[model samples]
Target: MTDDKSTIGQLPDFDTLANSLIEEGVLTVAPSELHGMLSGQLAAGARFDPDTLLRVVAELMDLDILNGENIKLILLELYQTTLAQLQSTEFSLQLLMPDDVHQLEQRADALGGWCSGFLSGFGLYAARHAKLSEEVTETLHDLAQIAQIAAESEAAGDEDEADLMEVYEYVRMAALLVFTECNPEPDDTDEKQPLLH
Candidate 1:
């Protein structure tokens, strides 16, 4: 067996300017910064700004890397996505529905499952450990509020889809972070085996 002192990843700095943009994305943040970040994600002819861009489009494949508990990393991705949406003129954020809300909720639940397993697997002392239950409990309530607004909008048959993906992305990222925390390794080799389960 390997020694119990392995350092997997950094405790991400939430101060990342990118996260600020995404968290602010659901709301209005400093727009110039977002404009620049979005420009960086685009190909040639994109007009945002070179100084503040962020691009690693290749992430979608290994994206399964995020499970549920790497809150900070997820936040970073959320920040980047926020920039992308803000940069897209064709995008709209005011036309969400019950279906979208339900899907987001499912995503949240999946994250919770991963978190539970992670905490169980890590014994609460590993670097990836997260008190996901609390963070998720709090976040879910606020998300419900957003869902209500969306359901009402849907009832009225409106189609704004305004900034919904931003919120959804946050939940998704949060899930990924939690998954990361709970699942420090891709294989089950280092996982602590329980005598009872």
Candidate 2:
């Protein structure tokens, strides 16, 4: 558990984004919200949801929290509380680890590729409501790579496979959210409106 906390903390923030999501060509993400989601303290119900969390993130980006570091005290507080809450759960999510790093990496890579394709629809889908920002689209691609690498099932001794699975679940959920956003389906009765660009 100590190792999991430390490992999670050590993961780097997506700070290399130079241009805003507007520059990314597709605008599915707000750079700031992603920063908070990816970097800052994990909040309750923080799992990526297109209309909810990502939208909040976009607002955060427009508000400039995306660029400013919010990990100083906020993330720490959230982490501790969230950790405690998670630990208190009756049953926790479990991850299974592969015996070999090479095998695990192979699996992660394949998963990542699929995830990347799924995420691409958010910006490119014909019905996606928002035009993807160039920076956010590129960043999400970068995220797909990081998520793939992070999905490696084998890690240093004492690292739990279950932890990795949990992390991967988060990654998958985020990717799916982006995909759905890009390719949203309209109501059965509502008039057709095209948001896809």
Candidate 3:
């Protein structure tokens, strides 16, 4: 457990940005969902290439949303924050999501979108598809199940709150485990610096 928290404090409001994106007809997936996808890729050992990520996001948006300076800056901050947090040695990663002010059902649905984005990002990585490790396979399956979460019209009671909390924790811990499993820390002893004559 790292003492570090996400640079979320320094970023713009999540729901505001998401709404802006929606109004602009930029993307179907929200910013939090997009972050989920990026985090998944980083966990799989992808480099923190902001340009490439922006390009991927633009592709996903169907139209370039970079024309707006605020949007561009927000995205840059998001990528930077996610990279910093996930790269922490203490497995300190948190999902970028709407605040608790939102309804539980809405939050759960957003999480489902986040999971769907995560699976999409995983699919983009050839390594994920090529391997057959049982643990990783099972993790992927679990994520897939969450991705299909549907919203309910009825108000959630105490049980739903408990279930949502469990799911949230599971998703958070699952991401950490997947990241650790895929990208083990490099052994310092294996490095051999070249001797200068």
- How much is the lDDT of residue 111 in candidate 2? 43
Residue 14 shift from truth in candidate 1, angstroms: 34
Question: Cα deviation of 50 in candidate 1 (Å)?
Answer: 47
**Predicted structure 3, TM vs. truth:** 0.79
The deviation in Å at residue 57 for candidate 2 is 33
What digit string (tens of lDDT, one per residue) describes model 3 on residues 1-197? 12354333343578877966876676677876787787777666665455665666677678754566666667777766675666566555677777888887788877887777777766666354456468877887898888676333336778887888788778877777777676667565222221111
Error of 3 at 49 (Å): 2.9
Q: Model 2: runs farther than 4 Å from truth? A: 1-102, 120-129, 132-142, 145-160, 183-185, 189-197
lDDT per residue as tens, model 1, 1-197: 11331422221232343344344332332222222222222211122221121222112112323232333344444444443343334332111112343444443333233223222222322323234467644543543454345334322112333344455555445434333334444354433231221
Tens digit of per-residue lDDT, candidate 2, span 115-147 = 443343232332323455565466466666655
Clash totals, every prediction: 22, 17, 0
Best by TM-score: 3
Residue 123 CA displacement from its true place in model 3, Å = 1.0
Most lDDT-accurate candidate: 3
Please list the residue runs of candidate 1 whose C-alpha ends up more than 4 Å from where it truly belongs after superposition: 1-137, 140-149, 155-159, 189-197
Give all candidates' CA lDDT scores: 0.32, 0.37, 0.68
Candidate 1 all-Cα RMSD: 18.1
Off by over 4 Å in 3: 1-12, 150-155, 186-197
TM-score of each: 0.25, 0.31, 0.79
